[model samples]
Target: MPDAGTLQLSGAGTTKTLPCHAGYLSVSGKNNTITLTGHCTSVTVSGNDNRVAVDSTDALSASGAGNVVVYHWGSPKIVSAGTANVVRQG
Candidate 1:
C-alpha cells in the first residue's frame, strides 16, 4: 500500500536531489537520477535507468532495468523485478 501523501517523481529532470520529509516516495520516470536525504518509510521505483540514493529506508521496491538504489542506515526490505538493477546497503 502507498501512502496517501507521498512524494512522487515523474518526467525528466537533471539529477534531482531531495530530502525525504514524507513517509513514502514513488519514482516513475526515465533517466532520473535522484539523491534523497533523511529517512523514508517506503520507496518505490518503476522506471528505467533511474539512479536513487537514500539515507535510509524501511521498505523498498524496484521494477526497472539498470536502476540503482543505495541506502545507508536501517535494515531495508527490498524487492527487485528486472535486470541490471542494483541495491546497496551500508
Candidate 2:
C-alpha cells in the first residue's frame, strides 16, 4: 500500500516532471527520466536505466541496475542497492 501523499510513476522510455509537495515519490521501470520539483519527504526508485532528479529530499533510495538519482539540495539519507545504482547530492 502507498501513502496518501505518495506519487508514483512507472513505465519505460517516458519523461515527466511533477511536484513533490514534501511528500513521497516512487518510480519504477526502464529508461525513464523524471524531474521532481518542490520538497520531497522521500524518494524511491527501482528498475533499470532510470534517471531521477529531485530539487530536495529528506530521504532517497535507489535500487535495481543502472538507476541514477540526483538531489540538488538537502542532506538526504541515501540508500543504493543492486548493480550500478547511484544516489547522490548534486
Number of the predicted model whose TM-score against the real structure is largest: 2
Best prediction by lDDT: 2
Q: Give Cα-based local distance difference scores for all models.
A: 0.83, 0.90
As a whole number from 0 to 100, the lDDT of residue 43 in candidate 1 is: 86
User: Residue 89: error of model 1 in Å?
Assistant: 1.3
Off by over 4 Å in 1: 1-4
lDDT of 1 by residue, 7-75 (tens): 888886548877786468899877898888888888898878888889998888998788888998888
TM-score quality measure for candidate 2: 0.93
lDDT of 1 at 9: 85
lDDT of 1: 0.83
